[model samples]
Each structure stands twice: as structure tokens, then as C-alpha cells.
Target: MNFVLKTILEEVRIRVFWILICFSFTWFTCYWFSEEFIFLLAKPFLTLPYLDSSFICTQLTEALSTYVTTSLISCFYFLFPFLSYQIWCFLMPSCYEEQRKKYNKLFYLSGFCFFLFFFVTFIWIVPNVWHFLYKLSTTSTNLLIIKLQPKIFDYIMLTVRILFISSICSQVPVLVICLLESKGVKTFIKNRRFFIVFSLFTAALFTPPDIWCQIVVCLPIYLIIELTIFYALIIQVYKRQLAL
Candidate 1:
């Protein structure tokens, strides 16, 4: 028992040390281009009717704070794959061949899906939603003079929120695949109604308290679930053919 406990402790310590080193290295490397990343995040706001190309910093430390936070986010973004690989390596020794393949597939699928939705959110959803909100805010107020002067910090945080939520949502297909493999596809089919309800609840938790936003987040997840089911069926058919 003592030997097992010591091994676990040593494994944890190594992981922590390497994680910190990876994060530190990534942070510095990402900090170099953090400004350019921030500029891209802020681009949607620039084209708004009353908003200018420039952003405003109200507090003396706001710029510093934004830069540090943005740099940290970018560092983690780049470090995610490495972190996942480290975790896989640590856990792989205990897994059987089948489990290892499943997890390996999961690793690649997660990275691909995450970045896929990240770009989709940034390139399409964020800008379109911002445009809609701009029109809604301006029209609803019925004001003769209206202006949108979003703070730099608030905008950055908003961008982070959208990116984080989209990345999480993008993992639905992976989650579905894992469930199909472990619990069997029939289980998901049987509980389809429950999953639909759960998806809505999930969308509510992730998105702002607005119906449209919830729908926007939930629709892609539902589509991914459908696609995963189709893929699973195809795989099962192929397996049966191989057996015969």
C-alpha cells in the first residue's frame, strides 16, 4: 500500500511540474502574439455602427490586466493538446489495448472538434450575434442618438466566454461516441428523449439567459449527436460484415 501510494504521489508531482513548465513556456511564446490575437477578437466590435476601431481602457491597470489575462488564455489554448497528451501517457499504462485505442481516438477527436467550433464561433457566430444585438439594442431603445463604446476588458472577457462555451459544446460528438462504445448505441437510442432534455439544460447553463442564444448553442450539439449515431451504425455494420 505504501509503495502504491508513493508511486501515485511521484506521478502526480511529475505531472504538476511538467504542466507548470509547459504553461510557462507557452505563456511567454503566446504573449508575443497576444496583441494580434486580441486585435482579431476586437475586430467585430469595430464594424458596429457607432463603435470606433479603437478600444477604451477606463482603469489605469486595465491594459495590463487585459494583456495578462489574454496571454494566460492563449497559453492554455496552445497548451491543451500537450496537457491532454501528458494525461493520456500517465493513464495509458493502466489501460488495455481496446481502452487505449478508444482514448487515443478521443484525444485526436477532442482536439479537432474543439478547434473546429472555436473557429466557427469566432468567425461566424460572434460577429453575427454582435451584429444582431447591435441592431436590437439600437432599435429597441428608439433613441435619437445611440453609441456603443464597449470596454476593452469586457469585450475580451466576452470573447473568452464564447470560445470556452463553444469548445465545450464541440465535444458532444466525442462524448456521444464514447457513450456508444461503452454503453452501446441502443442505450442512447432508448434515452433519446432524456438526452434531448439534458441538451437543452446544458445549453441553458452555458449560454446567456436568452432563448435565441440557447438555441444557437443547442442546435449544433443536436446535429453532432445525430451524426455520431449515424457513424456508430455504419461502424456496427462494418463489424458485422467482417465477422461474417
Candidate 2:
């Protein structure tokens, strides 16, 4: 009886120790994630000359908390696919093996492409866009803007929103594949003119109202659309051959 009780107590201690260890690691990771990556990311916005400093919150903690929260979300950004994979693993036994295999790459590529696309948007696209909008919009009449002061929370929120949206938009190929694969949306190969119009419309909708903004956004999408059509056509041909 004494031996059994001692064994049980040891087991509980081991389990608790491991749980605490795992939790400590994750907590430390969240801290480093917020501090290193997020703080660096916020550097550009923090140094921005135009961002008015007048929009001050009475609570000092408000700004710090906002920055921390923004960073925390960003830290978790890369975890989406990991979480998805975990879910996939959980559901794998219940799913048809072949079907699971087929969609596995789709699930993985989505998170990766999001990073790539958003990165492009942020590094190349957004800077140019910010410059253009800042320069062009403030012309003469509606200009002389007395340093527009934005709240720290609002700024962080806005940045996250735009970045996330653009990141998702970067997954145009994945979306195209889904439409072609699942839904019966026919590939728009024949109508180059219609493709042009449709592409422009989408760009205009997503981008700011400026013509330059419209053009810049549309051109890349248009290219992606073309590439998608090419690959889609190849797949269709392959499928048809298989059918015959």
C-alpha cells in the first residue's frame, strides 16, 4: 500500500512538472515574440514623421498595452498553419486518406502564401502607397493638415487590419484553385477583355481610389490571374486526357 501511494504521487509530480515546463516555454516565447519581432515592426510606424503625437491617451498603460497586444497577435500569426495542421491531424483518422492527402498541401500553402503576399504588400507595396497617398492627397486646397494625431491603439489596429487583409489577398492563387477545384467557375481564358475589366474592377475595389493605387494593385493581380489561368488550363487538359 505504501509503495503504490508513493508511485502515484511520483506520477502526478512528473505530469505537473512537464505541464509547467511546457507552459513556461510558451509564455517565454510569447514574451520574446512580442519584444523582438513586434517591437522592431512597430519601429517604422513609431518613427514616422507625420504621425501626430498630439493624440495622447490619458492612461500611459494604454499605449504600452496596445503595442503589446499588437505584437502578441503578430507573434501568433505564424501559428495559424501549425494550429491547422494539428486540427488536420485530429481529424485525419475520420477523413478519407486520399482526400486528406489531396488537401494537405492546400492547408499548408495557405499560411505560407499569406506570409509571402502580405510581406510583398507591406515591404514593396504599402510604403509606396503610403508615400503616394501622403504626397498626392495633400495637394493645395484640402492640405496644410495640422499633423493628424492618431491614438496608439487605433494606429496599431489599423496597421494590423491592413496588413492582414493584404496578406490574405496575396493568397489569390489558393482562392483561384479553390474556385476552380470545388466550384464550377469556368476558367476565363477566352475573354481577355473581360478578364481585364474584371481584374481592374477587383483592384479598384481593394485599393484606394487613386488611379495610381488602382494601377499598381491591378497589375500584379492581373499577372497572377494569367498565371492561374495557364495552370488551370493545364490541369483541365490533364483531367480531360485522364477521362478519355
| Top lDDT prediction, candidate number | 1
Residue-pair clashes per candidate: 0, 0
- Itemize residue pairs with steric clashes in candidate 2: none
Q: Mind giving the per-residue lDDT tens digits that candidate 2 earns over 116-165? A: 88777667655554455445534456546534444656655656655765
Off by over 4 Å in 1: 28-33, 47-51, 137-143
Model 1, 66-99: lDDT tens digits are: 9889998988888988898888888999999988
- Output the worst ten-in-a-row residue range by lDDT, candidate 2: 46-55
Q: lDDT of each structure? A: 0.84, 0.64
State how far residue 77 of model 2 sits from its true place (Å): 0.7
Best model per TM-score: 1
Error of 1 at 234 (Å): 2.7
